[model samples]
Target chain A: MKNTFNILATIILVLSLSATVCAEGWDVPASVKKKQNPYELTKRNISSGKKIFQTTCKSCHGDPGKGNMLPLQPPPTDLGSQNFLVQTDGEIFHKIRTGKGAMPTFEKTLSDESKWMVIAYLRSLDKMKREAVVTKAVVNPEVTDVKIDIDVDSEHKKLIAELTGLKKDGKRVGLEGIELSFLVKRAFGQLDISGEEAYTNEKGQLIVQFPTDLPGDREGQANLLVKITDEDNYGPIEEKRVVSIAVPTNPKNILSERAMWGTRANAPIWIIATYVLGVIGIWGVIFLILFQLFQLSKMRVKSK
Target chain B: MTQKTSDKSRRNFLKSFGVTVGAAGVVSSFSLLGAAKAAAKEPEEMVNLLTADGQLVQVDKNQLRPTVTEPLNELQKRGREGIAGKSFVMVIDLSKCRNARKCMDACQNHHQLRADQHHINVLQMQDSEHTAPYFMPKPCQHCDNPPCTKVCPVDATFKRQDGIVLIDNERCIGCRFCIAACPYSARIFQWTEPKDSEKYKDLTYNIEANVPQKKGTVSKCLFSADRLREDKLPSCVSSCPNGVYYFGDRNEDAVTNGTTGVTVRFSKLIEENAGYTLMKELGTKPRVYYLPPKDRAFKFNGDLLNEENLH
Candidate 1:
């Protein structure tokens, strides 16, 4: 029985070992593969997608085409390679939406637009498309001069920002598809209140609801920061506004009290008190004994 | 003559008794061997299992065993470097803690700690005789004025610029000075070979997470320095089923709650919730904050209450 059991165990172990060596293919659904991306592969989409990729996909995938992907059982595909780029946009989209093996599903975390933007960014890494992207950049220089207009809607409790960019010809056009972030300035870092949705609409306007429950300084004042997230393309565009839209807070400082365990400057008074009182009490007793001895010596001299 | 006669009789009696006993033993051994053979012949129970290809098959239950852990991933080996210009802080809500011990479990798993050893402990707390009892999940406060760091004779334990306290086991002589210096009793020492010594023997020591733990070295809550590098929450912080933990950069002045994923102003959260540090009188200037158990999420069931939990 033991011999038979050993034989059976060995066979099963060998079978399991071999199963891991064989490559498994990703199953892309027919309906998903046929679906087309609605968004255009513009520079704006590519740039925004690049930013998303840096934050979300950079760690595992590494730099595209650099072959610096993390070492895993089934290695992450270098999106720059022809093997990955040959797949249909819909096929890539479905793969990203419904992840397999080590890759995580981004359907819930990212919107459809964000996924398309990532694809657009990934497609730009192609050798043929690279030259075209550069030529297009030179032909139409990016608008550097941009202005932000802040509007506070008190009745609606909304903070609004409008962005406009000036062309070389001096004509101002509302900048669309730009990502804007909202944060409340604190002592150390800015607290992001933009939540999930932060992109400006076609009119270059972004509106965020002012949280009523947010605790502010004594007079209920808070510094609100509205800034463009895509600084690489748009440059630095930030506007700071002081708004009274939070619950008033009077903070208490707990470091005021002196403690025994505190530093030399902030040491407890009890130790010093104990040392002084102890010295006086001990010396007083010694002096009293000496005085009695002196009186006894004086009595002896008088008797003599 | 009488003594010799008795001695001869005694030897003869012993020889006769031994012969009978040896025969009886041999008879019993044959029966015992037969019984063992019978037990082995009895059919082994088979467990039904589905293959990766979706085919169901029957296999002996003895074949089932947990697979060996995979090698360290890239993110785990990503060094103990602190994030520049960032100081991390944690705020624990006493009201939310229900003695679930999920945080403890996560911390232990991340650091490769034994079941008895804990990087974070959920302690039962009560102030006075009539006061309400609450659960307090205590981790290393990572004090700015840390006594533990000051007492490290070999400089094995040190504080980082990013407000994280880490231990280098490679440099540790295991004198246990930091363990004695810590007033909060946060540090623990490995008395014997660490849990899974053989499995993790090849793994390089991660200074930030303090894993593959070595024997005779002291380890405590690292505040998940490794996870912080990836802008992720600590194991204890993220694993809590209740919204008990809030972790963030002190430099950002914002802390995101583990369960709710709600980021709030550090000062405002403390002021509004009346958050206070543990052992304020000690002047350790702890980075960890605690919200008072004013309005609790769950009633004090005392499920984890025992002799050790008492004051």
Candidate 2:
């Protein structure tokens, strides 16, 4: 329990520190104002959309997709309704043909497996329907309740993380994807890891399996370090965490435990060195530039 | 110094104008300084997106294209996700729904939804392995307390004054944070550039009515707030066959399933009976309410589930 707390507390400290450093008030600096979407008003998008609407749905939904269901009394709900805008993509497509309640469906009415055109018409109507309107950054720290677990199929291995507890502050700068490095130590050299690569989800969980083609793994035998590299305020970044992976073997299929990694394969020293050098290189360049600029301004004032 | 920089880059134009910004690129330092004076402005090749956590990285103009479309409402304004007064919400009655794909198809057809990227999806859900299964079709809940809005760093997915949630793909950086934050898993990310129409082919991004969903962005149902503005049912509500979904203004105290109008106090309807919200523990305060399986139509059909449909 104490060890677990130590690990958990360390994780918390790292996270809070990250959050404090990247607070939005810290200001990410301003971004270039992007131009409006290119589709603001063009032919192919709007006209093609109209074409699809005209060809397929006009009969039921009505021209310009403003159709009614039963005869007159209850005007078919407007296709151009704001009420329709808030649904999930799956729900909308499912309802079109099967018919929800009063309305007759068009599963048979229109059949363009690719529904991109329909989505287009939906937007076009909104563009034409609503009143003319107008419109309107940051990165900070990453706090994590992060850990990794490995699951093994008789032939493969899975890596998982308790990343859900990881939190990114509201004002945080965005994170690049996670970078994980799998390694085993020198005392045992290298343990065979049938499949060595693992992938992390947005929540920070990871799972990986060695291809059956590669040798299956053995039980309880490797030291692993998962390195995660993400973007930092200063420059690009990379980080690391260590864990143990013990590949369990299958008695039924003895050879299923084909050898994968050589135990000595703990991440090479070069990777850490490279990471440190890269970070230093990036920070050094920025500092050097700032220093020179400071000196140049001083010289200008002196001359004056 | 700034002027010299522009003159060096814009030496070609200096002949015509006494002091000028050269136009090799649109956003050079000198040109930026003399921006007001120059009409022949170059298009800035890049823009920066500030992540929710406060990271600023420059993104090229080419990177922010079609996926960035206008929103149907003001859901993407700064500091506006879960912005009170912009309280969009929805209620899905599970007892009313069946395996009927009507709502899904209608949504697809109406939205001109692209394949592989469902604006809404039907979930064959069971809270636990022992629990009975039900057809749970998902649309953007337009939550009153939307987790999607809460986690959105740029306020790309936001609530509107009239209780609607919408996306402004233009302002969206496509980080998919909203997708992760949504417990209902109501949101979907565009893995590839949407096979959008030509109209969006030339327009630059603006925040209103997100369109031409770009690659690497999050999108979900917007509850057809535009339809509601015109006093019409949402495409899904109007399209469902079994009257499975009911939509209405809680303030007006009326709800309808496209064909039938069932008027009752919104609060009373939820309280008088066993209406429930999915994943209630998550505190999303979804707009959609479920009537439970007390008296459902059609036997619970587990056989209709194709494993492929589980996702």
Candidate 3:
């Protein structure tokens, strides 16, 4: 009886504590939510994980985050970039595993199968060492003219875009609506377009294309933009490139407070009216007294 | 459009009323009774026009035209009519904006934008100096959680049934409060007389018809109710040389730029990462999306400085 009472009391206490925790928000610590990097997975791992990207993560980030890159348009994330590469890979993986920010948390909905697959795909996006490029190539119908030279030693390779244009006032002026694609055909059809690349120039040349997760060949017909000039004057196609893709990643939280959102906060009309009326009332009384005194002085002067 | 509130013409209050605009108190008075004229003399309380239900409406007596401003009651009714039936939206492809004020000019011409009261302003913007520069043509975001409407003491600036936000300039008391409260910097205050062109100035004032710009009031890109009534894209959406603005009805759940007829579902587009509101953080939830400034068709240069990209 003594043993039974002790066990029953302990079970009741544990259950009550659990109930209290549930009533609260089930808060996640910032540190736990913060991304963990060293545990990042690799591309070979994520190739199998594409199914998870397709199902749970595809809604907001799209399949591979390939947004329409038309001029006067919003440029979707180039997940294939170095800035994105250096980020805590596992942190991103965890973000996909359990969403945060604008992304709905998937801890509850996703099965273990789906979560692991997302982990594999995110591992695939980490900047891989660019494969060495060979100067020589042959005509291959399967290959597009886009030339890409990946670095041999570095998993993360840098593509410096050198735009040739007339020197305007001693500065290299990047022309508008300029499209430059460099394609390098590698051995054994191992097509590598700048090793999943993204680029930005010192002189406002943002024409490089980023690979998104639609089923486009990684080897042949690589169409990466090098330079685009005054395409905004033309039409959408003139200055834009739309590559079909669908890679579901963690939400980028792009919809946060924009510049204009800051400008709209201020006072309403009733407060302003009250303030104006107060000023006017004071002035009105003052003006009335001054006018009466002036009239009295004028009459006295006339009598004198 | 829940049963399209076909302006249930109100029975003329006090039969008829005339309004004029001038500093003069007594101008061309045609009083039916001497007693009525005497009693009306110096009624200080008559300056601010109050509605039958105790809402304040500024009636510029001389400027009054024979048009009904959608009352607060009607606007509230429309708000109850959610996006379930139909909602029109515009998505601006930012990669295409050339800072060409084409949309601005179109808006001005359509709304008769006074020189001092520009409804649309194209701003040169960038996320950071490191990021590429781009031209962002700003119109009213027509926020999903509009702060302007929230702060309006009289509920003057109300969001409409068709997902457009407009002000009853007739009720706008020139407090300029709405001007401060708008996050988009979308509102424009008329400081002086509109100095409208001889032809445009003669047009009478109407709530739906944003014309005959009055002095000391606020205005902004209205999505041109006049045009929407005719089933046409807003001027800024259509006039752009670049197919940047995609306008469509949310009820239909599809958007189109006249030239690039790529129709996509609105919510789907938002989820697919092609669409987003302007300022999601402030929770204004603008209904426009931007395609980032990548390999833009128009380089961010002076060439795109036209009137078409305002939407």
Candidate 4:
């Protein structure tokens, strides 16, 4: 009777442990769940977030509600689903930062501001949240003859951008409400620093904190680019300034060593030597066999 | 007497050589030289010319129209060589490809190929019964050690320094040895005249483009050598709607995504994504690498699954 009771208790304990392991809810911290999105949900901010989602997130999660996600063992969640809508913005943000199973963690790939913008974009996708949050279209104003200037503050580690445009009567005025992007030039593309919400203030100045952890050249020189974010309104206006910041990086040369695939003149010495030896060996054997046959024929004739 | 004999002999030789200098014997022995010098001074009116039969003649310069020079020789010479200090590499991310067929269409149009012919083919591949199916876009591997170039009886098929395998159809003696040796089956023989043969007939054959594709010659992918000369991405790489292809110089160790136009370190991208080459055991050392299809979003369905499509 005691053995039967013990067995039942063991079975119940094992089952309970397995149930906890396979639980559906992600264990998000209470503080993380309450943290609100920092960026404003503007039209430009949402569009910027949309581009990021298309490039990075769409591969796995797919189009929000389409049910076209890659068929995995445990499928990726649909962002448009009611289950996702129920979760707070902080819960979703935490989930993205620390991924589970097949989903990759976005902490390294995306910046904090970029993540907030992505959340804003996701909120805009829901009709109820779109009406509540995305009420204003704070985009770049249509200003022609705009000139941009960039200055680096070494003491404060800040990048300041000043925008000025010509008025109809040839008067230069500070252009306000103009969006700008801060990017560092990389080998193949640019790395975005300024968030979607980075806009010129009433004084036509945008003061952004410079990131200290960028990879630069041997001299620790990094090319800093300040550009108008709304390219459609402003026709590719931008400025570049070189700043001494970030750690130095030495890129490895994949082709520094001699490769096997080269011109015939550059063929390896062993290959040439092997070819010569092979030719001699094959021909020598053939000649030896021919000589033996000739000797046998002479002996046969002599015997006759 | 010696000078007279030498002059007379020279006059006889000039006569035999068909010099069109009128009354050669009556003029001084240096008459041909004098006339050529006189023609050189008056370049506006007259020009000295050499005939095919070793005859020297003076012609009116006004009658001469500049003959249009053919660039075929120059094209062939440069086509055999490749861009220096650059090794091209291509990376295909199978996870992103949705079988759009836009890449295939762009390649065919760029190469002037028929609907049946393909420079790049999108194949629906299923490894096993339980495994998920995926679309694999196959092009010339452009192997470091090309079997096609080795089996060629003539030097028609060759590998360029930029890791591209090109077929000089002009030198292909209608032999299909290369086709048999290639394990990838990347090559095709122009058994019939290529599509739009008549339209491209007058075009000076560009060895890089491999068009005006001649019948009875083997033709395969050339990595868009002509486009590379202009520093543009290959047609198939540039046409992908999804960020499926990353192409760039291996020497620079960078690759740019076709869709995003973002450049990244080649080695880092390959290392992080667990990139692999096709048939690594074959020892072909293909320049093209592939990132495995991890989490594909779309259903893998194609007409290739039909019974009639099976060979």
Per-residue lDDT over A1-304 for candidate 3, one digit per residue giving the tens place of the 0 to 100 score: 9999999999999999988965552244556556443323443234436655655455445645354222222233444455545545345555545554455666434544446556546545544532212112222222112222222211222234543343434444443222333232111111223232222243424333333331222231222333322233222221122222322223222223232212122234555568789999999999999999999999999999
State TM-scores per candidate.
0.45, 0.38, 0.40, 0.56
Each prediction's Cα lDDT score?
0.77, 0.52, 0.53, 0.77
lDDT of 1 by residue, B99-190 (tens): 77899999999999988998899888889989998899999999978898766765567666577878877557799988999989999999
lDDT of 4 by residue, B1-311 (tens): 21233334433676657665654654665776576667666557777899899999998875566667466657876787667656788999998777777888888888888989888898888889988777899999999877777666656677766767888777788789878987888888788989999998988888788988898888887778889888788889888877789988765556788877877667778999999998888888899999998855333455655542231
Supply the DockQ value of model 4: 0.08
Per-residue accuracy of model 1 over A4-110 as CA lDDT, tens digit each: 99999999999887776443456788888887767666656777789878877888999899999889877898888888888778999998887887999876456
Off by over 4 Å in 1: A1-159, A162-304, B1-81, B305-311
Candidate 1 interface CA RMSD, Å: 17.9
Worst 10 residues of 4 chain B by lDDT: B1-10
Q: Candidate 3 residues B255-295, lDDT tens each?
A: 66744444544456566655556778987778666666555
Candidate number of the best DockQ: 4
| Residue pairs in candidate 1 whose N, alpha carbon or C atoms collide under 3 angstroms | A189-B252
Better of 3 and 4 by TM-score: 4
Docking class of 1: incorrect
DockQ of each: 0.05, 0.01, 0.01, 0.08
Compared with the true structure, what per-residue lDDT tens digits does model 2 show for residues A1-304?
A: 9999999999999999978864521221123112122333232344445666655555556754344533554455556666764443344555553564455555544443324446555655664443322210122246454444444343344544322234555332222234344433321122223232233445445555532222112443434444442223223322233333343333231112221110111224565468689999999999999999999999999999
